[model samples]
Target: MKDIILNFGPPEELETKRILEVRSLSYLERLERLMAIIEVSHTLNTAKIIQTKKR
Candidate 1:
């Protein structure tokens, strides 16, 4: 779980807290996917901040 999720909080939203089973993914594969998601999220946040600064 540590490799997949950087931060966890109390369940409030069903979509964020939903559980899924991925039986085929190796530990490394899961980490890679998590990293990809983190990168994408970071990129999106940066873009949003830049747009705000431009205003």
Candidate 2:
């Protein structure tokens, strides 16, 4: 544990993790928006398929 701290330092690693989390937040939000768009597209496609099948 002491060796690991000497190698990387505890506070530095924590700060790096905090910075990474802050940077990834926007990417996460973009992914969420993409997922929502895909979900809606899938629903529309299913409705179209069902309508064609019924006709």
Candidate 3:
């Protein structure tokens, strides 16, 4: 299992949180196929995009 934090937008607080939600969902779905389980967390750190290939 892997835990990932997705940070989007700037310091300024946005009126709606829909964008973040959509992005998070998209990431989860994509990773779900490759990973056993996928979880998304909100954080202020940089985002990491990983690539995996099956040999």
Candidate with maximal lDDT: 2
TM-score winner between candidates 1 and 2: 1
TM-score, each model?
Answer: 0.60, 0.52, 0.20
Name model 1 segments beyond 4 Å from true: 1-21
Clashes per model (N, Cα, C within 3 A): 0, 0, 0
Candidate 2's residue-wise lDDT over 1-55, tens digit each?
Answer: 1143333569888888767855767777768867999999999999999999998
Residues 1-55, candidate 1: write the lDDT tens digits: 4466544666654345444444456898779889999999999999999999999
After superposition, candidate 3 runs with Cα above 4 Å error: 1-15, 27-55
Off by over 4 Å in 2: 1-25
lDDT of 3 by residue, 1-55 (tens): 3486565786554425645754667666757744633233322122332222322
In what order do the candidates fall by lDDT, top score first? 2, 1, 3
RMSD of each: 8.6, 13.0, 13.0
lDDT of 3: 0.48
